[model samples]
Target: MTQVAELPASAAEARDHVHALMATCPRPCGEDALTDALLIISELVTNAERHGGGMTGFRARVTEDHFDVTVEDASPAHPTLPGERPAGSVGGYGWHLVRRLATSVAVTPTARGKSIHVGLRLR
Candidate 1:
């Protein structure tokens, strides 16, 4: 079974929402995982605001095997996997970091917007 929650637009609010969701997950997800999740969420939200034409909403779902985080925004621009994080780059490392931390990552473009989902395995 999976529990789902919606996050607000504010970064602080989103962070708190994700923390609370992680706390309630069935499996024991570590602090490091939680921190990484939060960072990924922050990056996604920031991208939504800057590139996706503003975030519509975000969903956090905890499944029996994994924890899934999905961010929805107003634009149809699908997120891509970067080859590498260039040195001296101030930004553009969010998706890269998310892919590194999560067991799997996906991006789906819908009629409304695009959903960037990251899955963290529950061991």
Candidate 2:
């Protein structure tokens, strides 16, 4: 079974919510893994806010070997991985970071919006 939580656009609040939920996992998840998970959550939530037409909320689910985090918003357009980052690009690396940290990622259209889910393995 997995646990779930809904969160708003605030990155800090989303991170805190993820931390609290991850703490309940049966197998221990290291600090680094937790940090990565939170960072990915932040990226997803931020993207939803900045581009997804405003975030409806987010969900966090923990399984035996991974933490599944999903963020949903009002837009159907999914996030894309930028091919390259301009020399001094101030932003636009969220999806790239997520791809690096997560074991797997899935973006699917929902009834009302879209959900970007990242799976972070427990180590």
| Maximum-TM-score candidate | 2
Candidate 1 colliding pairs = none
lDDT of 1 by residue, 50-107 (tens): 8798888788877655778888899997754455545665567677777788888888
- The TM-scores, one per candidate, come to 0.81, 0.85
Candidate 2, residues 1-123, lDDT tens digits: the string is 457676654988888888888888888788898889888988888888888898886778887678988788899986765666556657777888999999999888999898887888887
Cα TM-score of candidate 2: 0.85
RMSD of each: 2.8, 2.2
Model 2 CA deviation exceeding 4 Å by range: 84-90
Number of clashes found in candidate 2: 0
What's the TM for model 1? 0.81
